[model samples]
Target: MGERVLIALGGNAMTAADGSASPDDQRRAVEGAMRHVTALITAGHQVTLTHGNGPQVGNLLLKNQIAADVVPPVPLDWCGAQTQATIGALVLNALEGRAAVVVTRTLVDPGDPAFQDPVKPIGRYFTEEQAGHFEKLGQTWRRFDRGWRRVVASPEPLEILDAPAVEALVAAGFTVVAAGGGGVPVARDDAGRLVGVEAVIDKDLAAAMLARAVNATVLVIATDVPQAVVGFGTADARPIGSITAAELRVLQAAGHFAGGSMGPKVEAVLRFVEQGGDRAVITSLEDIGAAVNGAAGTVVHR
Candidate 1:
């Protein structure tokens, strides 16, 4: 029997750091990533895919700013739409049989404290001068180790509105692609109608929610790093292979992960496993094939 798998693709899995964000470049990147997906499919595993739109959306944001004088700026929700369409189409092109990109909406607390102080960075890294320029336009920026970056609200996801569609797609033997930029952050009104928010959602958390909702057995988080590690970025840093979710939670509380990066991935995987997933993986873009085969990368289990 085939196991259901939900793959949360990190940006680096689809695009390279030195690569430009042209359509051709992105297509090439998607094709490469899909090779791993194809492998999983051949191995008789049902697959659903989600990806981070940090770079793609960042490029769109750049276009928004560059054309601000001539055209009204596009809303964050619309930018998410553009990325979902673009990336979804790219992946669906590589996938055989029927597939569809469901525009996902995730419910979040409208009063979430993240809105008061935005911390999620999207788009390209900017120099101090560029960051200052955006700040003057009433935008927010924070200095990262990679340099200054634009900050936006990243509220925790409460629910995935399109989860049923994802489940249906997989049931129909369709490769489902959804939840770009954390499912176009939205919240419900008093009457229960969804109201779109101007924010980006954490991709990993969103993917984990999708996994649990669809009852996927495996959740694969492919990132730039090889796997979760201890003392990251230091000479004494060490890779963590298979670990129980309980022990991983202890290590997380010990501060072995950084908030902006590995921390969220660890938290997301732990949630997946604790919620009854058989396995969760954290691995590099290049190792996705091996990671899924249990030959490489970090694995988290209950």
Candidate 2:
């Protein structure tokens, strides 16, 4: 039997060098990602796929805002859920019998500290005038380049609502994609009914929760970069190949990773290792197989 692996794909899995958001562009990107996934399947690994949707979700939000006059714009959470289903469906179709996507949801605590500070960014970039208009409407906005965008809170995932379903699908010999865009950021009410919230969940954190729930032996995170680097872009920069969970924690405490970038990836791997995962790999989509086989990328262990 193949080892069960959960692969968390980053934004570059969909975005290209030109930063186009068209369907053709994204499909091309996924073709490259699928090659890596197919290689893993051929190498005898039962894979469960998860992906970040920062670029896609931002495009969705922008479209929603532009069409709001003709159609009621969906809330952020609902838009997120819709993107999960959209991207997942396309990926499943592309897999052509290799994998199936489960439009999954994850549960969050209603009182997570993140709710007090909405910081996860979303939507297309806007000019200063456009940002000023949104500010007048009471939307939280931030500047990127000379433009601006709205941001939201990203809380920790408490549970994966569709983990059982995903496990069953894997047992039936199918690759599964779940928890896209951090599983739609929903929380349960007092009556136990699931309700969507106005927040996003970090994809890496959600991947960790899903990895734990499914008991995946390996957790591989595919990013644009091949390896995690320290001191990022200076003469002292170093590429990390392997490290213990303890060493990762110390580096994190020393602020070696940026919060909006590599920090969450390292943090998620540490959590997975600490919670009994055998190994974790951080690599780009093209190097996924090599990373798993220990020839490339950074590996983290307990």
Candidate 3:
């Protein structure tokens, strides 16, 4: 039997330099993404996919806000769920019947601390003046070079609601795409009915949870970088090729990874490995094949 792998795709894998989210542009990105995934499939790996929707969800939120006067704006959680379905459909279409895209939902604890402090940034950038306007309206803001944008809480994922469906697809020899935008954060009501919450769940953390749920042996997180780096930008910056989970945790404790970027990736890896996953690799989408073969990227082990 071939090894089963769960691939967590980063936003850049589907994003373009021009930031255009047109279907054609996304198709092009998906084409590039499939090349890496296809290589693994051809090499006899049973693959399941998950992806980020930071940019897409942000755009959805902006559209909702703009159309609010005529139609009430949807909440962020619903917007995230919508992006997951939209992007998952795009991925399924791109696969040309080779894979199945499941509109997945993930369950989170209603009491998660993130709800108290929505800190994850989403949507389009704006000028300082424009940001100030939103800020005055009581929206949380984060400033970037282009301007500022509203950020929302990104809680950790507890369970992927569609895991059984994903596993069924994988067992039936189909590639699965689920947990987009961290599976659209949801929590169970007192009656045990799933209800959407107003938070984004970190996609990487959700991916790790999905991997565990599916009993995948390998977890590959495809990011923009070819390898995980230490001391990211300075002259002493170094690339991490391979490391044990314990060592990675030590480095994490020392703050070698930035919270907004590399930190989540590293944390995901450690979690997966600790959960008995064979290995987790962090590498660029283009280098996925090489990374799997140990020719490139950072590989974390138990």
Candidate 4:
């Protein structure tokens, strides 16, 4: 029997290093990644997909800024929603319309501590002077390996608002594409109305929550690396094959993973396992087939 699997697609798999992927480019890239997904479906695993939107949303943000004089700029949440449609279309097409793209929304707490301390970076890199200019305009910018980029509050996801829709689709035997860009982070108002917020929710964390919501047995996070590593970017770096949640937690606490990059991924893997998921795999797209079969990648268990 096949297990229900939730795969979180990394932004690196869709966009280029410099973050300039046109729709045609993204379509080609998504098609390449979907071949792996197609293989999984062929093997009988029911699949649900979620994807990161940092690059896509960033491109939209840049466009908004460049044309600010001609048009009003869209909010962060709107940008997120737009990418959900854009990428969702690409994935849906690659699946030959055999899948459903749910325009999902993620419920978040308005008071999440992350709001006060924005750290999730998005958009294209800017020079020190350009970053300073944006800072003066009230946007926060942070220095990263590439350059300074815009950072937004990354609140923890409380629930996936459209998870039921995704579940129904999957239960009906449809491969579901959902929670794109963490489902456009939203919160409830005093009147219990859904209100979009100016924040980005970490897609991996959201995927874990969605996995638990939909009762998925397997969670796969596809990234640039074949497996999670300790001492990353160092000569002493090592690839972690199979690790228990407790052991991975120790390495995480010791700061082997950088908060900006691999930390959230490892955290998501632990979150899924500790929260009752049977297993989770962190692997690259090239190895997804083997990873699902337990022949490759870092497998995490309780």
lDDT of each: 0.86, 0.84, 0.84, 0.88
Candidate 1's TM-score: 0.92
Candidate 3 TM-score, true structure as reference: 0.92
Q: What's the residue-level lDDT of 1 in candidate 1? A: 79
1 or 4, greater by TM-score: 4
Off by over 4 Å in 2: 132-138, 143-145
Summarize candidate 2's per-residue lDDT along 1-302 as a digit string, tens digits: 66789999988887776778688888888777888898889889888999988788888778876775578667788877878887887787768775778888888899899888887777778887877766675578888775787877788888899999988888899899999978977888889898988888888988988998888998998898998988887899899988898987887898889998999999888999999999898888888887776677889987
Tens digits of per-residue lDDT for model 1, 36-70: 88888888888889998877888889998788778
**Location of the lowest summed lDDT over 10 successive residues in candidate 1:** 12-21
Which residue pairs collide in model 4, if any?
none
C-alpha TM-scores of all predictions: 0.92, 0.94, 0.92, 0.93
Tally clashes: model 3. 2
The list of candidate 4 runs beyond 4 A from truth reads 16-19, 127-138, 142-148
Q: How many clashes show up per model?
A: 1, 0, 2, 0
lDDT of 4 by residue, 1-302 (tens): 88899999998778765555888778888999999999999999889999988778878989976776588768889998889998988888888947989989999998899989988777888899888876776788999999998898989899999999899998999999899877888998899899999899889999999999999998999998899998988999999998999999999999998887898999999999999999899999888888877678999988
Kindly give the stretch of ten consecutive residues in candidate 4 with the minimal lDDT sum: 11-20
| lDDT over C-alpha atoms for residue 95 of model 4 | 86
